[model samples]
Target: MRYLFSFIGLVYSSLIKLAVLFNPKARMMERGRWKVWGKLRGGIVPGGRHIWFHAASLGEFEQGRPMMERIRAEYPDYRIVLTFFSPSGYEVRKNYEGADVIVYLPADRISRVRKFLDLVQPEMAIFIKYDFWPCFLLELERRQIPTYLVSSIFRPTQLFFRWYGGAYKRLLHCFTHIFVQDEASRILLGKHGIDPVTVAGDTRFDRVISVYEARKSLPLVERFAATVPEDGLVIVGGSSWPPDEEILVRYFNRNPKVKLILAPHEIDKEHLLQIISHLRRPFIRLSEATESNIDRQDCLIVDSFGLLSSIYRYGQVAFIGGGFGKGIHNTPEAAVYGVPVIFGPRYEKFKEARELIAEGGAFTVSSAEEFTSLIERLISDKGYREAASRAAADYIRTHAGATERIVRQIIR
Candidate 1:
């Protein structure tokens, strides 16, 4: 089984490398790995008593962030080394404040894992959410390193739960503890004989709330936000996938008076062109627009990075994307801004999405017809929008502090 897994990994790796040659994100991937090498060789990592955190991408980083901050405050002497499996997360957060070092996890091979462990010499490692690298995890287990999986959730359909996944299921036991997002995940892990599981909710709630708290004093955001008409409505589509943008563009065209801000998940030329072509109204790319150009267009297509969270503050209705595909993007980000969120139907895996819907803070549509109708009603009716917005904010407030909970258990 291990050999088969290794063979599959190699094939997947080759395909990824080929894909990178044609993708703009390829540069970010190579740059991140190079950055990691530079940090390691330059002696940037603090030598003694280090804590390691591994996240697959940007969302996972947010899932791990609250715990990262807590670690910094509680164990001031211990250094933080954050590693990423994908370029998206590392490239965006390479210069993150709390971490002493941010780097790419070496490819999951025995030799690479051994070398990394020798150099980093971490006292403990935190695997945020679903990034489980077999060889690296095996190395950590062999070394008796205290490793944990935080904000984890295991579904019945996961590879580990299958009859062919006995070997992978054994790997779950490598963790010193598993802090899952729900009771179902806890039950699944227990069925596999992996104990020491705790229901730690999700750390993303804490991360988003912190984003809102920090936004209170940012001068640039205030200046940019002032350009928005004081009485006009704000609709923010954040981390929007292509399909989500298509849905939004059609909706926006039907109501030209509404103010809309779109921050697509990928800012590449291909996607930018897709977004531009779908819009019927006069729209301005954020990069091309000046402060003087604010009122010149009804739609502002954000082609920038790092401002999506702050832009949410100006939103009365928020649409978080990626739900139409595998899952949804961060709901807490929009909820933090106190807005009603609407997305597509593939949200079964996102616990927060289900909870928010149950609380009347979010709505999920299985088709374009459903999404269009819900969005129109929300936009037209003031009372309905306001009620949903308040509910969204309340849902977020109730879910905060998963980070502290997980950290307390892990440190113990």
Candidate 2:
């Protein structure tokens, strides 16, 4: 099984190399890894015991960020090496102040894994959510490093639970301990004989709480809110795709009592123009808005990054995008602001989205009619909206403490 795994890694590396020729994302990942050795050898890790944290992408990075920040503040003896398996995480947070070293994780092969572990020599390893690289994890186990898997959720359909998943089942043993998001994950892992698993909830709940507490104030967003009529509501469509925008904008054009604010997933000129073309109402780009002119705009287009999280606080409702496409963006980010959230009809995988729906705090729509009816009800019925808002807020409050749980257990 081990030899077969090595052969599979070789093929995977070869395929990635070939993919770099045609896929821009693959090229970015390849380019990012090219400097990994240089970064490791060039004294990126400071002199201290090292604690390594691995995340697969931007989503996983966020799930693990609160842990990094917590450990950095609480334990001064350990240097943090944060590695990302995908370019989306590394490129966006290369200069993050929480970690001593930030670099792309090398490909999962014996030689590369050995070199990586040798260079950093982490005393502890933390894998957030998913992205279990076999070779690297096995090597860390061999070294007797205190390794952990946090915010993990296991399903019976995964390879580890399959009859043919002997190798994958062994990979789960590499972790010193596993902290899962829910009791179901804990029960599933225990049924597989994976011991020392704790139900610590999802750390992202804690992360979003911190975000809500410390979210920055945007003058531009506040000014735009002032432009809205007191009887009207602002609908913040965050990380929106064309599919999401089509439904949202179509309803906004017909409705006079609601203002729409769109923060698209991609703010590239082409996508921005597509969003603008759909808007029949007077819309203004956030960058171009002013106190004098902001009043004239019915739709506020967020052409900037880092403000969507903060801007959610100003809206009466939130439309988390990408559900009609890849999935939903962070629903809790908006839900933390005590707003009713709506998204497209593709949110089966997200546990929080499912929970929010069950709790009657979130809604999903497949078309413009569904959205219009849902939003209109939430808008007109003040009691219903407030009840939904409280549900959203309560969900966030209860699910928190994962960071404190995981971090205290690891550091203490």
Candidate 3:
């Protein structure tokens, strides 16, 4: 099984190398690891007491952020080592201040794992969400390292619970403890003999709440939000993809009175132009919006990153994107601001989205018609809108403290 896993890892590496010729992201993954071990040796002191945290991508990084910050505060002596499996996470957060050393996780092979383990000598290993490399887990267990999986969610369809999943199931046993996001995940793990599972909830709730409370004031957002007339509305379309934008563009066309803050997931020039071409209303890019006349535009197209969370403050209603594509982006980011939220129908995979919909804090739309109707109703009916807003905020408040719970257990 180990040999088979090693073969699979080699195949994966080869495929990435081939993909690099055409795919920029694949190129990044391959290029980011160039001389990685040398960089690791330079940054990480030998024999250092390191508390290592690994996240697959940006979303997982955010999920693990609260725990990283908490550990840094509580255990100042231990050096923090953060690793990312994807360039999407590593490239964005390579200079993150919370970790002492941030690097890309090398491919999972026995030799690579041994060299990494020998170099870092991590006191503890923490894996965020579901990026489990079998060889890495096995090596960590072999060295008697106390490894943990935090904010984990498990579904019955995962191979670990399957009849022919003996090899995969062994990986779960390597963890000293598993902190899951919900009771269903706990029960799933328990069925497979993975004991000591705790329903620690999702740490992202705590992180989003903190972001909301400490959100920076953006003058441009405030200016644009002010343009919303007394009876009009400001709708924030966050992390929007092309499909999500199409629906929003249709809605905006029908109701020019309502203002929109469109923040696309990717802001490359080509993509930006694509969004601009679809909009008939007068719009200005956030980068170009100034204090003097920013309020004159009917739409604000955000051309920058890192401001979407703060921009939610100006929205009376939020349409979180990515739902029409892979999954929904963060709903709690907007929900924390007491805004009624809406997303595409493909949000069942996101726990917060589902819970918010159940609580009447959010709604899901399958088509542009559904989206138009929902937004129009919410804007026209103040009582229903306010009820949704309250429910969204209350749901966030109740789900917070997951970080505190997980940190207490880690420190103990």
Note the Cα lDDT for every prediction shown: 0.82, 0.89, 0.90
Ranking, lDDT, top scorer first: 3, 2, 1
In terms of TM-score, how similar is model 2 to the real structure?
A: 0.95
lDDT, residue 67, candidate 1: 93
lDDT string for model 2 (153-208, tens) is 99998999999987899999999999998888999999889989999999998888
| Top-lDDT candidate index | 3
Please provide, for model 1 over 1-412, each residue's C-alpha lDDT reduced to its tens digit, 9 standing for 90 to 100.
4455556656655666677778756656755655666676564454678898999999899989999999899879888889988878877898899898888877665655677788889999999999788877877898999999998888999999999988888889889899998899999888878999999899999999988988755343344445555544667899899888877787778865566789999898988998888788777887777656655677888897888887888777888898888788888888877889988888888888998999999999877788777876876787888899899999999988899898888886
Model 1: ten consecutive residues of lowest lDDT = 216-225
Where's the lowest-lDDT run of ten residues in candidate 3?
A: 287-296
Candidate 2 wrong stretches, greater than 4 Å = 44-47
Cα error, residue 251 of model 1, in Å, equals 1.7
lDDT of 3 by residue, 54-122 (tens): 999998999999999888888888898899999889988998999988888998888888888888999
- Which candidate, 1 or 3, has the higher lDDT? 3
